[model samples]
Target: MPRPFVIDCALSFAVAVSTVLTSVIAGGQAEQSPPDWVGYLLLTVAAAFLVARRRFPPLVMVLTMLVSLLYFGLGFGTGAFTVAPALAVYTAITAKHRIAGSAGAAGYLAVVLLADRVGGQRDVSEGNVWMVIWILVIVVVGEVSRGRAEHLRAVAEQAARAELTRELEAQRRADQERLRIARELHDVLAHNISVISIQAGVAEHLMHRDPDKAHAAVATIRQVTKDVLVELRSILDVLRRVDEAGEIFPPSGVEGIERLAGRAAAGGIAVDLDVRGRASEVPADVGLVAYRVVQESLTNVIRHSRAAHASVVVNVDDTEVLVRVRDDGRGVPGDDVRAGNGIAGMTERVEAMSGTITAAPADGRGFVVEARLPLRRPEP
Candidate 1:
């Protein structure tokens, strides 16, 4: 049997033995019939009801109430507190049947008080008043226990919700970090690789006729390769990072765009790079986006435009950074720019900084990529 059932069995035996002794003392003093076998049976049944208190607390409350009333009416003794009814009321109240438990307690008290008056004992004894107080104390004690249990449950639920929020926030930050890395890698590799590809083709073609020019082209290829390696290493360092606020990123901005334009100009293209406003005032993140836009636009010119000339204009203001790149090659593949790493990647970067970008055919010739990057990034 369960431990509680075993405990209840022991309690029932003790209460039965105690009631017999109390009733015998009352028979001599109060002129009441002492508890015989019939009274012993009633006491045993009332205490036995305590065994099922946990499973059916309300039912135990009702059953114990009825049995106690019947026993008290028989003029036996419970001069001290009755243990069984009090236990049943405690179980019911603590088990969350607070109202039913109160009713049971009230009904038991009223019935016992009525039984005393009906049995011609007009004066209520002090012990009887203490018994009534003890039953109310059990009710208050049970409510306090239930209140504590409820508080613990509420605290546990709040802790679980807080843990879940932390996990979701972590996941969101991880996704944003991965996306930043991807955009960086794409911008770095696409521009430099296009330069290297153009230089390789130049070196191959000029190898037979112009040996000096071919060697210079090969030299450009080597430099571009080294630049790509340095950038890739920075990204690797970011990946190996162990915590936040200590990430490694490429040291790139508008200041680096001049070198970027120089590299593109060396790849057999006439390029004019212009900055009309204070370039130093741009925020680091916005500067990075501007650099990427210029880089991607120039890469498209080198790979697709087939034009010998390109113009890159950067106009920085207090509110925004404007980038306009135009080439005198074929305007674009089509009127509407298709999605790719070229224009589409630039679009993603510009929009992420709460900026706007437009890539389409220019007025008469060439393709133009124009972007306006805000000074501040939007809130996440």
Candidate 2:
């Protein structure tokens, strides 16, 4: 059986035993003792009904009150015999049946007062006063218990809601982190693959017609492949053990744009890199964003733009870094400038650092990609 049911059974049994003891003791004190069976039967029924008090508190109170009245009607005095019914009153009140509990208490008090008057026993007024005091005590105790139970219930509900909120926030942050990692992998692999593709095509075209040019192209491919593998290893290391605090890849910034331009030149696209303002003073994340914007822009130029030349401009101030990548190639339509994964990836990185990016065709010429990234970190 459940623990609460065991406790209720014990309480009910105690009440029944106490009622019988009271009746026996009181009968011995009476001038002429009445038969014991009627009192015992009435108190026993009242006490037994209390076992189900939590399930039907008001019903138990009513049944106990009726049994108590019958006991009094049979000339049995109200001594500890009232204990069982009093407990029923408390049970009803604690179950939040206030109106029924109050009414039951009032009716019980009236019955005790009437019983006293009808008996014409000595000091009847004193007995009635004592009855009222006891009833008030029971009501106050029941109300206090109800208040405490309600307070505990409300506290439990608030705790459950707080836990759910914390779990949802954790899941949301994990999703964002996963997306950031995927974007990094895409950017790294895409640039390397584009370089390898251009180099491979050059080596293949010159392999027979010009042996020296083909050998150089093959050398370029080897260097680019080695560099790509190093970067890929760094990315994989970070993925394998994310909690480690060491640097995953070599630090990349706007200064690396020179090496990028050289690689683009080797791929047969002449790149002009221009710097203005204090580029070295830019924050690491801002500088990295500037580098990525230029890298992706040039990759696009080599793959799509048939024109021979592209220009990269990097300007920095005390507060922000500004970047522009323009190509003198067959420009895309304005409507076709909408975000694909590459453009969307750039936009996500910039906006995450509180920056802005715009990509569109240049006036009467090739395509342009411009970005402005804040030097200082943004507030959460």
Cα lDDT of candidate 2 equals 0.82
Q: What are the per-residue Cα lDDT tens digits for candidate 2 across 191-248?
A: 7678778989988999999989989988988988887787777777777875556435
In candidate 2, what residue range of length 10 has the lowest lDDT sum?
Answer: 242-251
Name the top lDDT candidate: 1
TM-score of 1: 0.84
lDDT of 2 at 301: 85
Q: Each prediction's Cα lDDT score? A: 0.83, 0.82
Name the candidate that leads on TM-score: 2
Clashes of each: 0, 0
Which pairs of residues have clashing backbones in candidate 1? none
